[model samples]
Structures are given as C-alpha cells and as structure tokens.
Target: MSNYSIPYHDIDILIPSQKFEVNFSYTSSQMPNFIDSMIMRLLRISPLSVKNIAKFLGMNQRESRIVLDQLITNNEVELQQDGLFHLTNKSMKYFTTVDSIPKVASILEHTHSLIYELTNFNYIAQKPDNNMYGIKLIATSTHAANSENIVRDRFQKQFYQLIEEDIITLKKIEGRPSIYKMGTVKKVKECTVRKSLDLHVDAQAEPQAIKVLDSIMSDELKDKTYQALGQSKKGNNIRDILNNLDGFEQLKLNQYFKDGRFLAPNALFDSINPIESKSSDGNHLFIGPCYSQSNSKIILNKIKESIAKNHQVSSIYWLAPDDVFWGKSLRFNTFINALGQIKTKQNTDLQLKCFLPMHDEQDRTSVNNYRKIIAKDQQKYFYGIKDGILDGNFELIVVKNEFAVIVLHVLDSEAEYLTSFPFGSISYDKQLVNGLVSLFEAWERPKDDGGISFGQMFKKHSQS
Candidate 1:
C-alpha cells in the first residue's frame, strides 16, 4: 500500500474464453505402391519398351502406357532415342539403398484434430479440463470473422513442423516432401478456458487493467478481454459491463484489514480499568537477555509456530520502534527478517499490525524497504510509522487471545540501552494479557476518538 490512492474503483473480471474444435486433412508417405515400384525395378535391370513392360507385368499396352506416362511425369523414368524407357537419376532417390534392395515410398491422407481458442487464434495443446478454462463454443457456421482463414493458414505453416516434432507423425517422409494440398478445415466442437482482467481506477487516473500483476496473461489474452467487453450489449462503459455481469463477485481492498474475531472487544473486559501486573512465578513468566541473538531467534521461532500449521491466527499486534541513529536495532532487524516467514503463510488469514516509529530522517529508506517486504501483499500486512520519541527502547508482541511478549530495558542507562542487554519476560497470564490488549486498542483507536487509529494509519500509508 505504498502507492497513492485517489480512490475511484477497481475490479477483476474473470471471463471464460470460447474455444472451437477443428479437424484438418493432410497427406504423408504411408507405404510403397506395388505397380509403381515394379516398373522402376524392371527399368533398373534393363531398359524396356512399354509393350515389353506391359507383357512382363501381365498388363495390356494401353494400361502400361498410362502407368509409364505417370512414371514419366513423376520423373522416375524417361523415354530415350532408342525408343526404350530408362530409370532417371531422380528415381533412385525413392530407393532405400541403405539396406541391400531399394524400396519405394507412397503417399496417403490423414485426418487430425487441432483446437483453436476463438479469443486467441493460437492452437492449443488439448482441451483444458477445468470448466472455467473455457466455457462456450462458437458454432462452426457462425464464428468470429476471418477465423477460418487464420486457422487454416496457421495449420498450414505448422503442419510440417508438427510432423517433424511427432505431434503429427508421418510413417516416412525421407526426401523433402510437401503437403500435396490442404483439405477441408472446419470447426467441429466447443471448449472452455479461464481468463481474467485486473482493473483499477480512481479520481486522478483513467480506468484500466493493471497488467503488471498479471504476467501470466499474454497480449492476445488482453486483446480478447477488451474485445469481449467492447462487444457486450450489457453496458456502454467498461465499469457498467463489469458490474452488470451475472454472478460477479466484488473483491475489496480492505478485506484483510476488516476487524474480525480478534478485534471483537468484550464488554466485560472493556469495563475493567487496565492495570499493570507483574508475576514472580517461574512457570508463568520468563526472564531473558534481550540483546542475546540466540534468545531473539528462539522468540522468532515461537512466533512462527503460533501462526503455522494447525494455528489459525486471527490477528497480530506488534509495537516496535526504530533506533535514534537510523534503520532498526539488530534485535529489531532480526524480528523484521522473521516477518518474511510470517507474511507468507498461505493457510492462515494472518493480519499483522506493527507500529514502527521513525526517529531519524536516515531511517526512511531502510524502513520503507522493510515495509515493501510485506506491503506487496497489502491485504494482510498492516503497518504504521511516524517520527516520535518514547521513554525507552522496547519490543512488544501480542497474538490475540494467544500469548504476549514484553521486552524492556530494566535499568535506565545509555550503556544498558547500547551494548548491555535488556530484561524481558514472556507471559500468558490473563491479567497481564488483558492489560496489553487494552494498551493496543487504545493506540489503535481513531484520531477523532482521541486515539491514533493505527488501523486507518496503515490503510492510508498503504494507499499513499
């Protein structure tokens, strides 16, 4: 949510593309022709007149003449001055001399299936299994204009290559062979495909689909999306058509930020005035060195475990501030790095609200980059940052109705805040937990309500 928000409207349009099934006829070498090969074999042994060839082959001279004429046209034989026929050099090409005897090849026709999506003329691999992939089929008789010609031309261009790649296998096409000619190409059936448009707009910018988020959509897909919108009779404008679509579902940008179960305050707890309570029992409390890298890592792991696997995290509230110099403290950086793991939990609807007060101007770049890490997913990760001062350095984390962590400097001294480690405790005590929750709610309330309204602060920063 680092981008500016003038706030107009945005949407995602999922369109099921139309597909047409088509079949085409092509020619390829199948097997050898008996009569054609026999004639060539006889000529290879010795030159023979058509009469002699017809006599040896048990055919009348008329039939033999027709056969010889075809052979001559194919350049397999030639009539010489001696009035006899001889095998031409071109005739040897068809012979499979790789083995002892040369074998001749012949051609046969084949019918194969090719699918063409009407939205984009590109031939698809096969019918997609998902219904959302493509829905309606265009009738063969009434399809997009010029689609037939385009499909035919593309099939022609890819025909030979398809055979070479075994997609359209030919038994034998040894010498350079060409498609004798194209045959009937017609749509046979229909198919389905899933396509979508990610559109956004506001008061300051014109309405348009945000292409950056949709790297999977090809240029052709974009064209089809627009074409579909343009041809729709439902509405005059894109927004109108989108809204008018049947079964349309509006996706809200603030869905993740909405207060769910975690933000539902209890009247009884709200009625009780919050008071700080300290526990001495070892089992209910933990005392540790804050600057200890190992201790910080253990805490990070605890946070990860609370949100992972079977855990269903409703929300998270973290109160951590920047150092006076620039960027975050080493311990804070350790926690920031761990946020990557927390930000990307697919199974959980985790909402994290962190308050990072920027104390120095140099902290801007580092903090912004840190924000960018989770802001990419604006739905779940929420944050608030502003230049301010606090009494002391501390780190606090609370998982709604789960657990609370409070780390604070035990002694108010520069050395303790610098090189020396602070003291902290992890507690699940009900009173202590309620107190922290109260503090968080107070800080999160709206500015008009005498609170910072950290939720709106994050939302504004995200859109800004």
Candidate 2:
C-alpha cells in the first residue's frame, strides 16, 4: 500500500490491474512522455545518483541518463551531488499540495491537466458509484490559499497524457459539500505511480526478441521495392528480434495507459502466415486472411467447444499484428463508446472475461496520441479474443486466407460446427497447400456410405 500525501477522505487510490511488460517503450504509448514518468518516479524516490539510476535501468542506461539530465535542465529535478538528484523545491512544494486539489476536469480540455491539478491539491482519486471516476479532493494542506485554483493553474502549465488510463471528470451535485458525481463507470483504483504499459498475460510470460532481417528483406514489413522500414540505421537490431521469434509459435505485445493524456495518430496491425501451434492442441493454424470479422458467434462457439473438449480450455486471446489505439482504428468509436457507457466494476468484469492482461483492463480512448493514431474502438470484434487465438483451447484449428482454407488435422474427436473442416482461410504455401487438399481428399467417403459432406472420398480411403 502507498502512503498517499493527502487525506484520501473516502477515496480509495487503488492500482489499476494490467499485464506488466518488461520494456514498455515510447513508440508503444506516446503519452506521459517518458520524461514525465521518470520525473515523477524520481520525486517519489529522489536523491539518487545518475549512475545508480542508470544501473537501475540497465539496458536503458543511456536513455535514462539523458532524460535525467534533461529533467535537471528543465528544473523538474535538481542536481544535489556528483550524481544524486532530487525534485526541485518548486516541484516538491507543488506536489505536496497536489493531493487535495479539485478534480472536476473539462471534458473538452486536457484530461491530464485535470489530473495534475487534482493531484497537486492533495487527492489521489475518487470515482462515482459507477466507478467511472469523478473528482474528489483529498487535501494535503486544507489552507494553501484557493488550493483548487493553484492546482488548476499549475496543471495548465505542464504537459499531460490524454489516454484513458487514469482519468475522470466531476459532475455537479445539488446538496453535497463536494459531490463529484460520476458517469456510468466503476473502476477499481490502482495507480502504479509509474507511467507505462507492461502486459504480461500468463504468470510465466517472458520477454524474447527476434531479429527480423529476413522479414525486413521480405515484402511483409517494407515497401514493394523491399527497402528497409525507414530505420535502415536500426538494421540488424530489429532483425535480431525477428529471428528469435522463429523459436516461438506466437507473439504478444501490450499498449499504454494514458498519463493525463495527449493526441496521437492511428496505426494498423498485420498477421504473418503459416503460424505453427496457434491452436491449443499444439497444432498449427493456417495463416492467411481470417474472415473473423464477418463470422463471429459461429467461430467463437466452435472455438469454445473445441477448447472445452480437450486441452482444458481456459481463456481466449486476440492480437492485431500492429495497432494504434485511437479514433483511427476500425473499432475505435465503438470500443470507446462501449467502455464509456459501462460502469467501472462492469468494465473490470469485462477485462477478466476477455483477459485483457496489459493493465488488468482497457477502456475508451479519450484523445489521440501525438502520433495521431487511435484504437479501432470495435472491442466487440475482440471479445473472447484470447480463446480464439488459442485454437479453441486445444481442439480444432481454424485459419483464414484470401481464397479458401486447408484443414490440417482434427484431433481424435469431432467438434460440432468444427466437424466441417477448413472453416476459413488457408495457408499461403504451394507444397503445403497441395498437401492439405490431398489429405482432405483421402478422408472423403461415398455419399451412400453415410451422408457425410464427402462420403465418396471417405469410401475411397476406406477401400485403400
């Protein structure tokens, strides 16, 4: 438990749950601008040497040191010793009072600014019964002269993250001394103090990078001419990360939690083909074009039953090859709107049901990131996403392609809708493609033999 600077009153400053990532980069979450997160962390655990800080960051020593120096230059942190640093007196004083400021934010303005002001006034946070947070001042210093006013001013001057990570606005109350009514959201309070998104799905998840040199040379990542993806300078480093991927059958990444907030661009994701072990039975699912968008319940139910049959189905998993969580995504407006409408507690339940590990949860996009990207608010498409990715928890295999499908193998048993092999797309391989068709042909039987889809083919195989 954290010792909050201000009196929480009835507010509970709980940490939001999320999937922890080892290295959440600026490229991933554009808000909170690494600088802001580091500064805040420094202030909370101040008076540390630059070398110590660098060592703490290890692989990020250089970047961390540079940012630390920048903080001093910016007057956010003061250099006290050879390598030691502390928050500037001004910052200390401001933060001290940040605990109890009014949190009523303008839905039209920067949400981060409101959060900053509220923190300055001595409040960690408070939300309405819906769990969609409203403003609640916890007051560290009840008499700091128009505490709310000062906080508001300071926040107006600083930078802010515009994502929906830690944010809420105040609604007026007719009779309460400080009634910050909420919208229809009820989220458990969990503030990690640090600003970043680390999504670790399973407890034993580990970090692994692959060098994608071959991929860089391929048509998937780069342009038609096959030139590197801009960062020719980043060369082999990116390649190394890609190569390591060959060892694993799947990959997962996390998004960011907004710090305050900012505006950014929308991005997209792409899926590669011939992914092995995509399904639970440790079998490979063809990678082509998945019609998952058009067919929902049918696919979901099949996957659900498939998993339940064998590998002890647990959950679902879904991932876009690449994505930008903002207005640009195909599902952005829908996802945000839905999240906004639901109560925070309900949102929490949704997170568990869907298994959105990156932060124990996810919600609407309040603003665009600096990159100008937005999430494809269509969470409906991603519901039970994790399970879908796992191949029905270890039973059947469904892959998508541009034209047709290639049913690799059906486990020992037959799944309901799954009995109809090759539901969606097929792999993009010549030899493999022909091989699959041959296998399917061999499994066919005579129509009179029973009335299965291909009885003639099955009879031929029986005779053989």
Candidate 3:
C-alpha cells in the first residue's frame, strides 16, 4: 500500500470563477483541507498576514482572530497582534527542515485542487528496476482488512474505478517520490429540474395527499397568473405556446409577465431551430412557436435529408398568445399587425398561420392581432397537451438559453427531455428544490380526461 494521500474535489456549485491552469509542485496530500489551502494561499501572497489570512480563509476580523489565537496556543505560530501571525523561529526552522512531519503533512494536504489528465505513464519508480508505485486498479476483498497495507490495497482498487469513471483525472508527475494528480477544477454542468412523478400511494402516501391538498389552495402566485392570462377550460381549445424564459427572481418575472405571454421566470435559454418534416401522406405539422419550434424545423429538414425519414415540412403552424399584438389582423393597430403578418407570411410554398388555443376575453388589447388569425375558420381542438407540457417532439430543440433545468421526472410520462428556462429558475443544489417540486404538483393535472395516457402512446410509437 502507498503511504501517499490523494485529494478529492469539492462538489459545490459555484458562479463561474476564473480558473488558472496551474501546474505547481504539490507539497503533500493530507487532510484538514481548509488549513492546507490556508498555507498554500499564504505562500502565494506575502509570508502570511492576518489580513491575507482573512481574505484567503474568507473570514472576517473577529473569526480570523479566534483562529489565530488557537494557532498561537498550539505554539504552531506566533501572533504579531498588530498585523498577522508569523511563524515562530523554532516552528519556522522546524517546518523548513527538509523531512519534518509538519512539512510532509502540509504538502499532502495541498494537492486536491488540480485538474489533471493522463499523459501516458502507467506508474512510476525511483529507478528502472524499483518497485512500481502509484494507483493500481482491481477488486480487493470488501471484507475489512486487519492490516494497514491490506486496507490500502482495497482502497486503491476503488480509486481506480472512480478514475475510470472520469470523476477524477491524473494531473502531473515529478521525480524523487512520484505523485499522482487529480481534478482540474472547472465549471461542472448541473441542472435544476422540477420533477413531478405520479404519487405511488404505497411509497408516497402521506406527502402525495399533502401535495394534492396544497394544489387545491388558491396560490397567490397561481391566482395572480390566472388573473393575468388564464383561459377558460373548454374540451377543445388549444393555446399556442410562446416563450419559456429564465429570470433571477422567479416571482418577479412571473409578475412582470403576468399577462401570460412572456418568458418563464428564471429560465436560462438559448435559441434552437427544429427541422421540418412530412409524414408518409402530405400532412402539415403545426410546430409550436419560438426557438424550440425553430429547432424542430431544422431537425425535420435533416430528417428529410436522411434515411431515417426523408421528409420535409410543407408549411409551418404557430401560436400567438392573447398578449401578442401583431400578426394576422390588418385593422387593429395596423402597424403592429402589419409587421406580425409579414413575419408569418414568409415562404410562398409554406404558410405561417396563427393558432391560439384559448379564447380571447372581452378586451381590445388582448385580441388586437388575433382577429386576423380567427383560426382561419378551422375548428379548434383542445390540445393533446397543456401549458408547460410537451406532447411530442420533446427532444427536437437545438439552441436553448444558457440556463436550463433537466427535469428527471414529470407527471405521467410526456417526456424524457430537456425543458427550456423561465420555468421558475432552478439550480441543482438550491434548498428550494423541494418547494418547487411541490409547486409543480399543485399545478399539475391530467392533460386528457378520458384520452389515452402519454406513456401508453409513447410505448406504442416506440414499438411501431
């Protein structure tokens, strides 16, 4: 078993920081991670001052003083009082001595923050014929080992598994005693998802009922939203979705777009273009609007060019929310509607018609541009899906905002896909995840009353 220690990365989410591609001679790999960092940071700046220590340790004067007092009591350091703690002459000499335990301990503790990649060497040794040193991968007895050497061998086997999984990577090497490096600290992508799973009564008996009850309560948030842009439920009314946006404060964004035709609050998004395609028969598809629909069109185009389903979209169908003031209508505020009409009427062979699922309430501003759409005298069918729900083409999005939440689960099984932001901005580690999940539960309802389940449809489609 090797006596040397290995450092592990802190799995904390962070606002991106400037990362230095550092290649340093790591002193050692020991525990007391924060202190180890403290020493390294001290050496980098001046030879350690209380001010510097506070900055490095992220402590204020009062807390810094407390720790400084402890170091002084241990005789590990001397306090300048007016300024920082200085290493005592004896302590300095002791540490500076080449092979002191403190020196080795400090080195071992400082090696955890680097990101490294393998550059070839399997293992290293002092001389060509010396014993092979470094990590080795293999299963060892999970049975508790009585000896230190035996225990280390088991851990070595486990370490290799982690390495192979890319949880860590080898960083660098040097002479004398060989050292292995791990983890080049960088922004690891994470997603904040609001998952809604149908309650399993056997497992989630208590909480599921609590969730349903919560939904029945008139939520200030939901009520405010309903007041702004909610539509009356009819069996066949389909609303055209517009945008899902991200916001810093979800409540604020929701309130700002209370009218229901703006981006979802706290959604981080990017533009995506979907390809267009046709089925075996010349059926036209009404791809939903905004960037998601755009990506769908692009993807459909590729499908047309590929053997998977050489199809092309002959026309595009879109939605215009009640808040949308343009497109279709020429008489209501002619200028805005004119611009909207121009946008929808782009291709000669393709048509860009408006589709709004919900009926307009008695307000001129609400239906200003919708008059021209009039569903073009076509019968409106209640959508197979609802707001914040994707019927199909869930994975067709191309470009999305920088912020996105990866929902692992949703009510029933409409998707195993990514939803774009502004759905109450979520993050991987925020304490609010539980609250957000509860919110989704309150708002969730069956998309179809007697219609087939999305899961059943998905399975049927897959089998076909």
Candidate 4:
C-alpha cells in the first residue's frame, strides 16, 4: 500500500482555536483492540516504562512485558534507548499527536455533526489501485435535517482540507455504499482526459446515425426526385405538388421518386444510391428510413449475402414493431420471401427469434406465414411488448455471431420531411452490434409466458 503522511503540527496550524472547545474522548471499548487502546492512551501523555505501564493499568509486570514485546514484534510500537514505550511511525499516520488536541477535537465535532445528519451510511475501504481514497459519503435519509449535497460539499472542501493536503485526493463519489481510496486530483484529471480522447476517436472512426439522415435528406437526392416527378407528369412542377403535401407525405414521395420500383410514374434515372460495401469479416450495420419496397429489398439482400456465404445461419434475433409483419407491408413480404429462399438453399427450415409488439389484427396473416416457414426442430419465439420487455421503437436484426443491424424509427415531426421516411440514423458499427448482442443475452423476462425457452436456443446455437 502507498503511504501518505503529513506532519501533525502542519494540520494544527490550520485548525481554529475556537473549535478547540469540542471534546475528543474515546472509551476503552471503542478502540479496535484492548492492547491498542492501552498503548495509545499510555503513549499519548508521554512514553512509559513497561513496569510503569503494568502498574498503572493494574496488570502483572510479566503480562505487560509480553504484550509490549508483541507490539514491538508487529512494528506497531517502538522501544526507546531509555526503555520507554511509544507508538511506531505507522500508527502515528492515523492519529494526530497528543500535542494537537485541538485539531483532533475539531475532527470529532464535524464527524458527530455528519453522523447526526445521516440516518444511515456505510464506508467501504477500497484497494490501493482504486481512484478514490479516504472517507466518502454516499447517501442520507430524506428525512435527515441536513441537505446531503451541502453537507458533503462543506465537509469535503473545508473539514478535509484543514487536516492534510493529501486528503483532497479522495473525491470520486458513487451510488449505494460510499468508496474511499488514496488518489490525487492530478490522476483523476488524467483519466478523464484519456477517456475523452478515446471517445473522440470512436466517433470519428464509425459512421454516426446522423450521417444516414443527412444522406437521405441531401439536396442532390431531392433534386433528382423533383426531376423524376416532372418527367412523369407534364406541367406538374415540384413546388406546386410539394405545397399540397404534409411533411410526412413529402418525404414519402421523395423516397418513391428516387426508387420508382415502389410507386407508379417510373423515373428514367435511378436515384437510389447504394452504400459502399465493406469486407464481411466483421459485423456490418446499415441505418436509414425503410418506408419503400426498394429499401426493404436492400436490407433483405444484406441478410442473404451473410447467409449465402455461411451456408447455414445459426440464429436470428429480431426486434421490430407489429406493423413490420403486416401482410400489406413491403418489408413483411420481402422478409418472408428472403426466409423462403434461405430455407430452400440450405435444405433446412429457417429459425427466427423475434421480439415484437403485441399482435394486432393486421399481423395475423404475416404471423401465420412466419410460423409455417420456421424449422420443425427449431422453435419460433415471439416476445410481446405487454411483457414490459422492449424499450424502444428501433428495429434490430442480429445474424448469429456474425453481424447486426439497428435502425431507429423516426417518429416526431421535428425532422419534418425526414419523419415521413420510415426510419432514421442507421449504424453498422461492430462494437455497437456486439453490445446489443450482449444486452439481448442479459435481458430478463417472465418465467411462464416469456417465449420459447432461451436455454434450449442457447444450447443449440451458442456453440455455432
């Protein structure tokens, strides 16, 4: 362990004389051990001979000698040339010298006040490597008289400052039990700076969710859509038509204008630009709106690429809204068709584990089709929102241990035209994909109606 010590006299100079009125007394039983209390109290006034200590404490000389000899053996106390007993330097590190009675008294007073304010508190001594060092206050009862923040601030800034300069190092606070460790502000500052730099690098390296939105709303894509509209209908201009549409309808029309495969009035020029593909060694993610059939086809194609390369897809986890599986939805049709192709190529049934919102009237046909495609040996798990499991509207698709895609649904009108697009901000970041996989593994659900058994699925697929 690292040692941090300062002369008691230096601390004494910082304490006020008026605060000396408070008493700092300890009953014998309050000491950690009987031998410690006896030795501390005896050495506080002045060093003493073993015979003198034994006589004062009413013990035999031999018994006293044995105890004092043990203290010497443990390096807790030292014997001077005059044969007098005194505390070792190690012991002195914790307690102020007897000459600094006023400083000790002031500490006791603050401690008493803090204890009175807190209805309950706990202290956990941290290891040497821990960032925090020394006494740390975590929580106090709501009914307590003192404001927790105010009291902690005052104690940390004022009371601790006067005692020792090194004490200022212990400042990191966490929830529940308080943590204390030996650390300096310089070390903490360095750690913060390092973490900030790492985050900056991560942000720059990965494609952010916002970038997908930017691509979809680019002026170039908009201009292409406007031109396509003009060619399809004579004398119908972009401004006149856009003026009559709501924000959502305008975005939906813009997407359709780019990919004429979904709507009527086909365009001469193809506006649906493809994302630059990367090596499939690691996880890949794609994020963007998915309202059009063309976009759904793109997503389905990515999944086919993964399944085709591996021959057999070990497991598939999906989190999506109930509407995504509606019979009328292009996404539903595309997903179902893709599953059929995969099953035929592998000569085995497709296995899908889905977390979807509660079943609605529109989902009946799609859900029935889904059950028919899944393998007989492999079970299909469907988790409902009423179970209080899912947290967001974002769609997630993970293909075994290989890759995952997360597309956040755009719901509000703040993005105006962008809201009309089915989704926003897509990320194919490998780190994020792995984190989602772990999150799915750790999530809890009810025992009875959760879904097909997670254990059986894990045993079968985890090995792959």
Q: Can you give the TM-score per candidate against the true fold? A: 0.33, 0.18, 0.19, 0.29
The regions of model 4 sitting more than 4 angstroms off are: 1-292, 322-331, 344-346, 359-381, 385-391, 414-420, 424-430, 444-464
Cα lDDT, all candidates: 0.48, 0.27, 0.28, 0.37
Query: Which residue pairs overlap in candidate 1's backbone?
Result: 1-462, 3-464, 96-103, 133-192, 133-193, 133-194, 134-192, 134-193, 135-192, 445-453
How are the candidates ranked when ordered by TM-score, highest leading?
A: 1, 4, 3, 2
Which candidate number would show the highest TM-score if scored against the true structure?
Answer: 1
Off-target runs (Cα >4 Å) in candidate 3 are: 1-98, 101-316, 319-351, 361-464
Deviation of model 2 at 145, angstroms? 46
lDDT of 2 at 376: 36
Distance from true location, Cα of 95 in model 2, Å: 86
| Lowest summed lDDT window (length 10), candidate 2 | 261-270
In the order shown, the candidates' Cα RMSDs to the true structure are: 20.2, 28.3, 26.3, 24.8
Which lDDT tens digits does candidate 2 get at residues 154-207? 332321221223333322322112212222211223222211111111111121
| Tens digits of lDDT, candidate 3, 1-464 | 12211110001001111111222233332323366435433633345777777787788967877776776775656766556567655345334433333333333312222121111111111112111110111111331122223323323344545345654355432222222443232322221111121221111111112132143232532232222211221121111221332322332223323333332211121111111321222212221222222322333343234222322333333322322211212121222222233221223232323233232122233232223233322223111112223321121111111111221111111211111111221122233334333333332334454322122112222221
lDDT of 4: 0.37
- Model 4 is weakest, by summed lDDT over 10 consecutive residues, at 8-17
What is the alpha-carbon lDDT of model 3 when measured against the actual structure?
Answer: 0.28
lDDT of 2 at 355: 18
